[model samples]
Every structure is written in structure tokens, then in C-alpha cells.
Target: MGIKALISKPFAAFTISKMNKWKYNAVAAQEKVLQNLINTAANTQFGKDHQFSKIKSHQDFIQHVPINDYEDIKPYVEKVVKGEADILWPGKPLYFAKTSGTTSGVKYIPISKESMPEHIKAARNALLCYIYETGKTDFLDGKLIFLQGSPVMDKKAGISFGRLSGIVANHVPKYLQKNRLPSYDVNCIDDWETKVDAIVEETLNEDMRLISGIPPWCQMYFDRLLAKTGKQKIKDIFPNFKLFVYGGVNYEPYRAKLEESLGFKIDSIETYPASEGFIAFQDSQKEKSLLLLADAGIFYEFIPTDEFFNEKPSRLNLGEIELGKNYAIVMSTNAGLWAYSLGDTIKFVSKNPYKLLVTGRIKHYISAFGEHVIGEEVEHALLTVAKQENVEITEFTVAPQVNPQKGEMPYHEWFIEFVNPPKNLKEFAVKVDEALQQKNIYYKDLISGKVLQPLIIRSLKAASFINLMRTEGKLGGQNKVPRLANDRILADKLEQYIIEK
Candidate 1:
């Protein structure tokens, strides 16, 4: 809007266009790179195979390499830990990134030391894209406050590539590292609480210009900051702050609260962080969901949502995919993961391949009945119903509960917390029922007596639910009661608190 910004608009636009083009080109080149890696991994016997076998096409590779889970790679991880060079990939094994495995408490994911450069490049590209889109290169000089894991190392720990955060911290410039705040370094294998006191101390050292981390953890950190400094407005504490980069979960549900507490329209960016890799970022001006980093060190394979959880998946390539359709993401990464399911779903916003929006987690879905309900669907439904009834649902959740009285159809019990309570509560409930029925045909037919119509709108105080979670031992800053519930156990627990009150 300024004279300088107006004059410089075209240059910024050009940079964005060029960066987007570069990403598109990278997507197009994925097949060749993937083939090369597959061949090289096979030739060098990275995991189990030994022989540079030919993979002429995408189909050939998929057909030959069986789809594998973490369990399949456990042996290779063991080998790498024993200093078995080139066991996972044809390079020195970097340190392992620890991930919360489903069964195993923690699993160390392996990465090639050579691939570290790729991670840096991908991260830089995200920054460059952000700069181009926001047209805010002036903030580049400001101190960035990355709300990342603490950079503590175990005395006997050797440099491993699996803990993604540790790898990043290890690679940051030593000069910048020295100036980093006195926080509990928890990137190493250590209890997080051990360093909490130290982290609180470090946060007071300087005014952070940029804040980056998972939304929950960042919120928790700020809550701690509030306690430490007796401050409410984060901007007052860190007056120079320009951006708040968050990811690892959807921020929409908590955005209003965060903005209110911060006291500024903080520029926000979302990132895709995983044990396998830092996959994508939010770079668009309007869209809030993360854009797939197509040009990053991973070649993507998308399995249709219906086909994703199947034992035998029908995977689609970039050339074969469509927009708005949900797909489970699989990637061949520089970290030596081939056709690995990333446990996330994404939809393409544009055909550019490099740009995508993460929809939700694969595991987080509630289809108790025939009505398939995902987090996005639930969020959209809540907004729609609230709009129709002229109310704002500040907090809500849907759960399937059994109606043992025999004749009634099972209902989706909703617990809603509204900023402005609706006077026409019955009409509000009807509107919500109508919204659900219209959006999902299964629910519509069910409402027509084919099955049970969903019950909507049981209101409760917001703090009551928060207090319940606290009682359940998930307290303090980060813990949030899940927005959707499928089973009766968690649903019953939530119902007991909100149903009566």
C-alpha cells in the first residue's frame, strides 16, 4: 500500500511466479529422481536388496517394491545403529529422528547424512516462497524466534539423523546457535520437563521477531511466558515480532484465541513436520493449509482415500491426480523411505503439483455410522450450522452414543460452547440437523428414517470441558479435548460433563 511497496509489487509478483515455476519443474522431474534412488538403493543394498536393478517406470517400481510399514524397516534401523554403513542408503547414516510409533513408545527414523543439504534447501525454499508472497523481506533483518525443540544432547549420543529437530539444530550456524536463548535443550533423548524451567528463563532474554513451532506447544510456551512475566499480550512482551509460523495441527479452531492474546494480526505460516521429513509449508496469500513442497527431497505418491488404508493400494502419480479429491500421501524421501505412508491426507488446490493443502490426519476420522465424518467435514458443518442459526460455536465436538431404549436411531451427540448463546435453541438444533443431512446423503437418508438422525446442540461452559481434561491428566497449555469423537468411551465421558450442565 506504500509508494515503495507499490513500485516493488511487480518484482515481488515475478519472484513468486518464478519460485512457483521452479517448484512445478521439480514436480515434473520427480520420476527421474525417484527411479535413480530406487536403482541406487537396490544396487547398494541399502535395506535388503543388493543389485542396481532397473525401474523403467513408476508402475515398475511400485510393482517390485512391496508397500512397507515401520515394522518392515525395523531391521534396517537396527543395522544402521550398529554402524552398518550403507545399510539403509548408500551413505553414512545420520542420526535418527525419534517419532511416536503406534506400538513402540518411540522409533528412531534414519536419514542419510548426505541428504541434510536437501532438507536445508527445502526449508530455504519455503522461506523464499514466504518472502515472495508476503512481500515482507524487510523483516529478514529482524531476529527470528523459532519455537523449536530444545537443543540438548546426551553425553554419549553420536550424531544421528532420525530426530528431525535434532538434525536441524545440529546443522544451524554455530554463531546463531551461540546467541540462542538459554532454553532446555530437549532435542536429544531427555524428558521435556527437565528443561522447562530453563526454557522459561531463555524466553525472557530478548524480544522475538518471529515465532515458529507446533501450535499447541507454542501456546503452552506462551502460557508459561505469561506466568513468568505476568504478561497477557504477547506483542507487548515481544514488540518486534512480525510472524508466527505454526504447524503440526490445524490452527483454525484456536486462531481467534491466539490473535486476541497476541494483540496483533500476526502473519502466520504453517509447516509440515514429520520424522521422515519436513514435507510442505503454507505459502499462499489466502489459503491457510500447508502447500506440498513438490520440489523438496521427496517424490510423492497419492492413494485415493477409499484405497489408502487397503492392504493393496492403487496409488496415483502427479500426472494422474485431480484437485479437491482426498488422498493418503506416500513419499520416497531423501531419508531412505520408499513408498512410505506419511499418515496424512492432502488435497490439491492447483495442478501445479508443488501446491497442496493438508486436509487432516489419516487416523483422525469419525464414521461410527455410515455417515463418513472427517475433521474438515465436521469443521465445515459446524460453521454452516452456526451461520444458518446466527450463532458462533466457539467450541464443539460430535460423538456417537448408543440409545439403548430400543426404538430410536443412534444420534451424534454434540457439545457446543457458544460465545453468544442462541435464544432459539430448538431452531438452532434443527438447523444443525439440516446442515448435516444436506452435506452428507447418508445422514439425510438416516434422518428420513432409514437410520438415526443426529442430535445437535447441547451447550456447556467452555471452562468446564477444559477443567475435565485437566482432571483427566491432560492439563496446562497444550492439551485440548479432541474436536470429534467416534467411540462411546470418550463420548460418554464428555457427555457426562456437558449433557447435564
Candidate 2:
């Protein structure tokens, strides 16, 4: 082992032990976190406005604070943006994570001095847990690359603002600084394609051991690496590339194609992170579940996804959540967000140690008909059939086709970009349709009752999704194509990329 591995092993063990303490006492940990947040923010303007001093229990909290979306907090956020102090939290925010918003145009999420360390700590502890589980800390010695957004920060009234991934880039630990790939100058490049080309050039000949990013962007990086070096598999270019750290999207749909490009299977770690907070990470190699970060400076709540839009949805605390049921995640954090809805859906996989899987975005689902298929269901259906048929899916999305030709039933249109096209498109579509039907009984009923026709597969040429993303200026960073959509907004754009065959 290299000196780095030697140093990290003991530290990894220590961190895992400390983290396990929270796992065993998850409920108490959250209670303490909520209390701390209340006490710390008791003097802030929001605290005063909400009668924070009188709130003592979760019930009290619920009575005083209704769940808030970004618009609900925008007025206070505007105050912070104008350099106001003690408006939301204790003081002015340390940074603003700027994200593209729908109605608001751009959302500037606050990251307080007290909350920033939790993000770094959660990321570090995730790696530590991986090392402790597999005893493979040697990756730390070689070059590591995180295919991320630019590290450039735009200052507003003395506070830095940038993509959350880019902001995290600025906080890399000193120990790994020398080993991290893609020089600062390259990372600062604005355009995705240009930045990717620069990353390929920098890491083409380096001893890269670990690659990290959203799977699609990482796929884009691998494509660039292959084109630059004319190598068939990524392993040919970086033999030591053993670990893949990915977040933001489920990897099952991308697994077959990604491994085909890699030339072999490799271990991976999935993380559940957002601008709101770093929520969870895969703590074990044996299971896909991500251990929730109860002690990570955030208190969490859940409302059953079906009831999310209800006038008075039942908000259940962490200990009250049951396994395998989809719930919309809500959070209150040291960042000054109180009873804030994350707009993400998650299902708990294990209650003992508090492990969960991100099921979908609360708003990103196909319910045009009564068949409300979610991100997890669609991914599972497509991935299962792809693996069985020996087909490789490069990218795919499902949108409701409520409008159809005369005398034809409406259907769900699946736009797929395939590496290995199925030999019989009709047969392949039937299998995928059946798989989805099995997962969603509502879809099955619609099909059997002749309410809708089976799904249609519109296979597209290679790089179709990539080109669309590029055209839309979302080709990289945290951006990803949605798995399911209720409307044809994205489907209409995808039509132009369809392969005529």
C-alpha cells in the first residue's frame, strides 16, 4: 500500500465507528439537531416571525411552520441577496448555490457557516466508509478526477455564488489536492464540450484510479477519452480506474452501456446529495441502500408521495417512516431552511440503520393517465428488459402520448438511444411494456381495458440525448434527462433526434 492508503485506513475505521453511533441512535440525533437549529436561530427574523421561542416539540414546529417551497422563502432570500443579516439564520449566508428554477428563473440557496462543514464531512465520511468496507484505499494514491461543473464563483455583495458541485470543488481536502485531476484552469472552462475536451487532455496519460460525476457526464468524458486516445474500453486508457462515485440519478439504466465501455465490472458508490443538503451515501458494498445522514446538520421529515399535494399532508418524522413506501422528503437545516420541501421522493430500504433510495423527483412522474409511474419504476422496467435482451441502452425517457392518430389509442412514448439496437423492435417493445405493466398495475389496467395502447419505442441515433442537452445548454454538470414526464414538452424536442428506422 502507498503512504496515503496507510494513513487513511485507521482514519477510515475511526470515522465509520463514529458514524455508526448516529445510526444506532438516529431518532435522538434528529431531535437534538432540530433543537439545535431552533436554539441557534431563535433570534433571527424568521425565528421571530414564526414564534420560534414557543415551539418546543415536533407538533409545535408543525403548528408554527408550514412546509415551504422556494417561492415561500424567496422574500427572505431576496433580503439575504441584498446583504441583510440575521434575516433567515444568524447572519448573511456564506454562499449562494444558484440553480435554474422554473417560475423563479434562478434560486439562490443559502449555505451558512454552520452548515457548510456538514457537506464536506458527509462526502469525506462516505469515502471513508467505502475504504473501511473494502479495504481499498490505494485509489487515494493515484490521480482522481471529479467530472464537475466549473469551480468559478461569481461574487454577489461579498458572497460567492455558483453551482453546488462547483462550490464543493473549492473545498477539496489538501491531502487529495495533488492527486485530483483536471487542473483548475480546465475546470474553470464554461462550455461543457470544451471543458470535457480539456479534462480528457489532462487525464489521458495520468494514472487515474477513481472517476466521479453524474453518470451521463462521466459517459461523455469516457467518450471523449476514447476519441482522444482511440481506445476501445476506458480500462485501456486508465487501468487503475476502480471506483466510480456518482449521484443525482439512478445508475441501473446506464449500467450496461457504462460497463461495456469500461471492459469490466467495477465497484461504485451512489450518493444522495442536493443543493438543500448532502442527504445520504452508499455505506456498504453489499447493498444498494444509502445510509441517511441523520447527524449531518439537517432534520428530516416525510410525506407520503400520494398525499404530497393534499391540503394538509401528514408530515411524518424520520422514526415514523416505514420501509419500501415512497415519501416526499422534507428538511430543516442549519442553512436556515425550515420545514423545507426538497421536492425529491425517496423510499426507505432499511429502518434499523436508516438507509433509503431516492425513488424520483416529486414533480417528475408520468400520471397523464391514472398510471402514475415514477422514476424508479421506469428505470427498473427498462433496465430489466435491456439486460435480458442483451441490448445496451445509452439513454431513454418516457412521456405520455395523450394524443394519437384517428382510431388509435393514446400510449406512452419511450425515446431510447441504444448502443445495441434490439433485433426485433416490435418484440422488444412488448417485453418492455409487459415489464412496466408488472410494476404499475394502473398501466396494466389501462392496457388491458384498451384505454391506452402499449408503449412505442422511438429509437434514436447515438449521441441524440447528448446533442439535445448541448443544444439546451444542459450537457454537463448536475443536469440529467428526466426518466418520466407527464407532458410532451421534452418529447417534442426529442422528436427531431429520432432515427428514421
Candidate 3:
């Protein structure tokens, strides 16, 4: 056996065994995880405040701890930042994953040594599981290029701070580091544009076997590689490339374009890892759904999307979740997060293995004029329209046009940056409107009652999204265009950047 296969053989076996055990008894596995999480941190301040010692069951834990967002947890995190020990997790956190804040500047999430292993181990198992199921071990022999964020970490109040991906990239195992591309020196370049240029120069002649990144940014890297090599597709440059692993955004819209760039079909794996913890990953090649890591370091709770905005919402554990319902995910993790709102929404597709699809974000939707449209609905409508029109969309965003002149009704306006523009823009808009009306009853009712007008579509020039991200200081690496907005806050700004036909 090759060195790659030899190194991964034991891990692949372990992952498969764990997958089988969890598949048969996901509920039991989740309950055990919850009990372990409680017992692990029962002495921490947060655990004591919630009376974790007295808590005997999931119900007791929920009854004591309320669901919290970043704002609610800031005070405790602040204490940790000031060198306080055992504020949330036992002792001090090893590092802090700094995530982009919605209103605030940046939110520092704790990542304890206790939880770091969970993140690294789960990601490793995700790949190993894919290898076991597909018998695809050649990737282990070649280089794996992970287009991650900058690994240059900053010390703040005795803790390291940087992007979660960057931190994880720095921690690639010693054995596998030989197959990983982009030297550590190049990864430390903080400027995104400069980093991409350096990565292109470094990996141009390498024998790459696997590529992992968010789709849009990975597309950027692939474009650069093609340009440098004068190649038509990525496969032409890296013939042995076998897998494309991605996460942080839905891959549906980018799938067609990415395949076109690759020149052939390749297997893919999707993972759902947040700054707080690694949540779920695609285990079975037969299904697109991601299997929840029930036995991992995180304990999960779900609140129905419709009830989440209420003052008090009912929470359900893994055993209580029903398929097909949208639920806002709440998580308690080894990283010192307790009943924390991860701001993500998901819909279960399978129960035996507890597989799910990420539906949307909790605060990301358009409900102006009572036409409640979510990110998933908008993406589905756009995909339908694109497929029907034989077009490819690179990036897009939707916002409600609530204010109208006299004799005008409210409507949802779409700003789309297309790789392949449709032959007829008017027809494309009509198809999109029809799709949305079919998918969302609220939107359809508004249109039927004349409370809303037909959806508006505006085409943006190529690379407009890159410029938008540049202007917002989030040009690359895990930053994605917000798919839906309640109002035209972003739409109006984007209008200035829109290309006139």
C-alpha cells in the first residue's frame, strides 16, 4: 500500500465503524453526547449558573439555560478575554475564532483545547468516511489544496485570534502536511488578493489530487490556475484530481459552473463547520444530505423556524425532530457554548442517520408586505430559472423593494451576476417569478391580491460581486453574498454597481 493509504487505513476503518453505530442509534448517541458535555464542564461558571450538577436530563438542561446569541454571551466571553479561567470552559481557551458580526465589528468565539480535537478529528473522519464508502484512496497520494484564509494569527489578551479555517489549516497533521499545498509562509499573507496570487504561483506545477474550499473562492483559484496554464479546464492541469470538498455555502448554484470548469464529473463532500464547532458532514455518497455528528462533541437542539422569533420558543432534541420542518439550530458544545443559537436553519431529510440540508440563516429572509420569502426559496427559484434558460449564475442577492411610487406595488428585486446571461432577460424574470409563486404560498397570495408586483431582475457585470466584497472588506475566503435582505439596504448600494444594458 502507498504511504497515504497506509496512514489513512486505520482512520477509515474507525470512521466506518462509528458511522454504522451512529446510523443505527442516532438518538441514543446524541443523548450520550449531551450527558458527556454536561459532565465535562459542570464546574465552569456557565455550568454552575445553570446548575449543571443538578441537571439530570435534557429537559432539565433546557429549562435552566436559555437559548443565547452572541450578544447574550458577550459578557462571559469578555471575562475570558481578560485572562479569567473557568469562565465558560475549564481553564483558558487555546484560541478564539473571530467571526464577522452582523451589527458589531467582530465576535470572538472561544475554542478550547478540549474542543480543538473535536474540530480536527471530525474533519479528518469526514474525509476518511468518504474514502471508505467510495474506495477513493488515490487522493491520499497527491497534494490536497485547501484554499483557506490567512494563517497569520494575532495574540490578544493571551489568546490567539484568526479565521477558524486558518487556525485549522495550521493544525494539519504532520504526516499529511507533506501532501498539503501552499507553504505556511505563503498562507500567512493577510491580503486576500496577494494570497491568491502567491497560491497560484506555488501550486501551478504540483500534482494536485483534491481541492477543498468554498465554491466561489475556489472558482477564483481555478480561474487563476487556468489562466496561468493556458488550459480550458482544471482537469487539464491536474489530471489526477479526484475530489472537491466544500462548505460554508450552498453548492447548488455553483455546481454547474464548477463542473464546466473541471471538464468532467468528480465526487464531492460537503461539511457544515462553524466557528463554534464542527457540526455535520456528508457521510454517504448515495445521498446529498449531511449526517449530523451525533456522537461528536456537540449536543444539538432545534426550534421550529416559525416559533423562533417568539418570546419563548419550544426546543426539541434529536429524537423529537421531524423530517421536512425548518428548524433553527441550537447547540451546546465542548467549546463552552451552551444552548447557543448558531443562526443557521436546517431541514431534516433522513432520520435513521439523522441527515439534513441547511435551509438558510435565521435572520436572513424577506418578509416585507407579508410575503415571507426565505433564502432557500429564492435559491430554488433562481436555480429553476437558470436551468430552464440554459444559463449559469455566478452570484446573486435578493432584497424587497418596499417603497414604490404612486400606482406601483411592492416586489422582490434580484441583483444577479451571471456567467452565462439568458437570451431573453424578460422571459427569465417571468420564469423566476412563476417558480417563486409556486414554492411560497405567501408570495403567491400577495401577487394574486395585487399586494405585490412581478419580481424584478437586474443583471450585474461579471466580477461585480468581487468588487462589492472588496468594497466591504470581505473579498475572499468564506465570505458569501447575502442571498436575501428584508429591505433595500444592500440593494440600493448594489444598484450603483449594476451594469446598464
Candidate 4:
């Protein structure tokens, strides 16, 4: 066996065995996880405020600490940002993951010393689980390239601040660093366009066996690599490449283009990591759904999406969740977040192993006309249209055009950037509209009753999304086009580049 196999095999086996045990007894495992989290933070300010010490069961904990979003929790996070001790966690946070804020310019999420290791461990186990299930260790023998954010973190108030991906990249274990591509100096480049060029230049000839990044940026890397080498496919340059690990956005829309670029079918793994914590990952080689990390130092609660905006919504624990229900995920993590709403919605697909598919964001949707179009429905419609028309879409976003100045009703406007334009744009738009109507009954009724006009399709100029991302100041890792918006804020901003078809 190779050195890589020698190092990974035993650990992979152990992880799979433990994961299997936890899978069957997820409820019991989660209960223990919650108790441990409560005990660990019982003396902290947040814990005391929430009466964590007095809480003994899930019922008591839920009643004590109400569910909260970023806005609701920002005050406590602000205390941590000001270098206050024991505000959220026991001591000051090790670092703050700077992400785009919902109401403010930026959000500083705490990363305590106790929680940082869980983030790293969950990430490591994601790969180990893949290896354990697939018996694919040869890829580990070659260099792995992770297209992450700039590793140069800025320090503020004695705490480091940067993207979660960058923070993780900066802390890559010494052993793995030897097999990781793109030297640290190149990774430190802050400008994304320049950094991608440097990455292309540095790893052009390396034995790249794996690549991991969000889909759009990774597509940029592959496009540049192909352009530089004058190659038909990526496999032409890196024959050993075997895997692609991706997260942050749905990979279905970009799958065709990604596979085309690679020139061969390769195993792909998906992970659900956020500034809050690493939540879940694809555990089985045969399944697309992600297995929830029940024992990964984070306690999970689910609130039905339909009632999440209600005055008082019911929350379900791991034991109470039913299959095929959409829920807004609430987490109480080792990072000291209590009943925190991550804002993302997910639907459970399997019950025994607790596998789920991320549906969309809570605030990201179109309900301007009472049609209630969601991100999942939009993605499914787009995917259906793309398949029917044999076109490849690079990026897309939807917004409700609420005010029609002319003698017409308001409609859902779709701005699409296509890599391969459809043979007939009008037909493609009709098919997309029909597919959406089929998926959502309310949307169908609205269209049939003429309460809402037919969906409008406005083709975007090639690479227009890149300009859009630049204008929005979210140009790189972990940032993506917001798929659906309730208002015309993003649509009006992108109107200048729309091809008036």
C-alpha cells in the first residue's frame, strides 16, 4: 500500500464505524450532544441569560432560549467583537468569520477555541467518509487543490477576521500541507481575479488529483486552465484528477459544464458548511443527499418553514422530524450560538440516516404576487428547461417586477447568463414558465387567472454576473448570485446589462 493509504485507511475505517453507530441512534446521540453543549456553556453569560444550567431536557431548553436569527443575536456577537470575555462563549473567540451581513455591512461570527476544532474535524471526516465508502485513496496520493478565499487574515481587537474558507485553509494540518497545491504566498493574494491567475500559473503542471471550491469560481479556474493550455479538457492536463469537492451553491445547474470541462466522469462530494458551523456532508458514494453530522459538536433543531414566520412556530428535534418536510435549520453549536437560525431551509429526504437536501434561504424568495416562488422551485424549473432545450446556463437570478408602468400586469423577471444559448429563446422561456407552474400550484393558478403576467426572460450579456458580483462586492469564494428576490433591487441593478430579447 502507498503512504497515503497507510495514513488514511485505518482512520477512515474508524470514522465509518462510528458514523454507522451514530446513524442508527441519531436521536440518542443528539440528546447527548445537546446536554454536553449545555454543560460546557452553563457558566457563560449567554448560558446564564438563557438558564442553561437549569435546563435538563429539550423541552426546557427550547422554552428557555427562543429561536434567533443574525439580527437577534448580533448584540451578543458585538460584545465578543469588542473583545469582551464570556459574552457568548466562555472566553474570547479565537477568530471571527467575516460574512456578508443581512442588515449591516458585515457580520462577525464567533469561532471559539472549543468550536474551531469541530469545524476542522467535520471537514476532515467528510473526506474520510468519502474514502471509506468508495475505497478511493489514490487521489490522496496526489496534490489536492482547494480554491479558497485569501489566507491573509486581518486582526482586529486581538481577534483574527477573514472568510471561513480562508481560515480553514490557513490552518491546514502540516501533514496535508505537503500534498496541497497553490503555495501559501499565492493563496494570500486578496484580489480574486489576480489570485486566480496566480493559482493557474502556479499549479498548471502539478499532479492535481482533486479540486475543491464553489462551482462558479471553480469554473473560472477550469476555464483559465483550459485557455492557458489550449487543451480540450482538464483531464488532458491532469490525468490523475479523480474527485471534485464543492459546496456553497447547488451544483445541478453547472454539472453539465463542469463535466464537459473535466472530459471524464469523476466522483463529486458536497458539504454543508457555513460561517456558523460545518453541518452535513455526502456520506455515501451511491447517494446525493447529505448525511447530517449529529455528533459533530452541534445540536440541531428544525422549524417547519411554513410556520417559521409565524408568531410562535413549533420546533422539532432530531427525534421528531418527519421525512419530506421543509424546515428552517436551527442550531445550537459549541461556538455558543443558542437556537440560532442559520436562515437556510432544507428538506429531509431520508429518516434513518437523516439525509437532507438544502432547499433555499429563508429570506430569498418571490412572493410579490402571492405566488410564493421559492429557490428550489426556480432551480427545478431552470433545470427542466435547460434539459428540454439542451442549453447550458452559467448563472441566473429571479426578481418580481412589481410595478408595470405600461398597460400590463407585473410579472416574474428572469435574468439568465447562458454558456450555451438556447436554440429558441422564446420557447425556452415558455418551457421554464410551464415547468414552474407545474411545480407550484399557486403560481399555476395565478398564471391561469391572469393575476400575474407570463414570466419575462431577459438574456444577460456573457460574463455579466461577474460584473454583478463585483458591483455587489461579493466576487469570490462562498458568494453566489441570490437566486430569487422579493423586490426589484437586484433586477434594477442588473438591468443595464440585460439583452432586450
Clashes of each: 17, 0, 0, 0
**Any runs in candidate 2 off by more than 4 Å, and if so which?**
none
The per-residue C-alpha lDDT of model 2 at residue 166 equals 94
Measured with C-alpha atoms, the lDDT of residue 331 in candidate 3 is 94
Off by over 4 Å in 4: none
Candidate 2, residues 317-379: lDDT per residue as tens digits?
998999999999999999999999998999998988999999999989998888898988888
lDDT of every model, 2 decimals: 0.65, 0.91, 0.89, 0.89
Against the true structure, what is each candidate's TM-score?
0.82, 0.99, 0.97, 0.97
Give me the candidate number with maximum TM-score.
2
Runs in model 1 lying further than 4 Å from the true structure: 1-21, 44-52, 153-163, 174-201, 224-232, 384-398, 402-408, 414-430, 456-501
Model 2, residue 123: distance off in Å is 1.0
Candidate 1 lDDT score relative to the true structure? 0.65
Tell how far residue 68 is off in model 4, in angstroms.
Answer: 1.3
Write one digit per residue (lDDT tens) for candidate 1, span 1-501: 334335445655665676666566755667766766776677445434623375677887777666666787778767766666666677655667666664555676776655676666555556666667777754444455555553444321364433466557667644345334443243332433434445667666675766767665566566667778898788778887787777666776556556766887888777776767777777765776566666556778888887866888788888788888888888877668777777778887776544677777676666776666666776666676665555654566777765635676677777776656677777877776777667677767766875776565678765555556656754432234566666656656666556343
Q: Where does candidate 3 have its weakest 10-residue lDDT segment?
A: 1-10
lDDT tens digits, residue span 1-501, model 3: 587777677779876886788777989988898888888889999989889998889989888999998899899999998889998889999999999897756899999888888888878888998888877788888988988988889888889989999999878988789889888898888888898989999998889999999999999998898998899999988999999999999999899999999999889999999999998999878988998988777889999999998999989999999999999999998889999999999999998878999999988999988677889999999998798778999999999888867868888889999998998888899999999999999999999999999998999988888988898889888788889988677888888767773
Sequence-dependent TM-score of model 3: 0.97
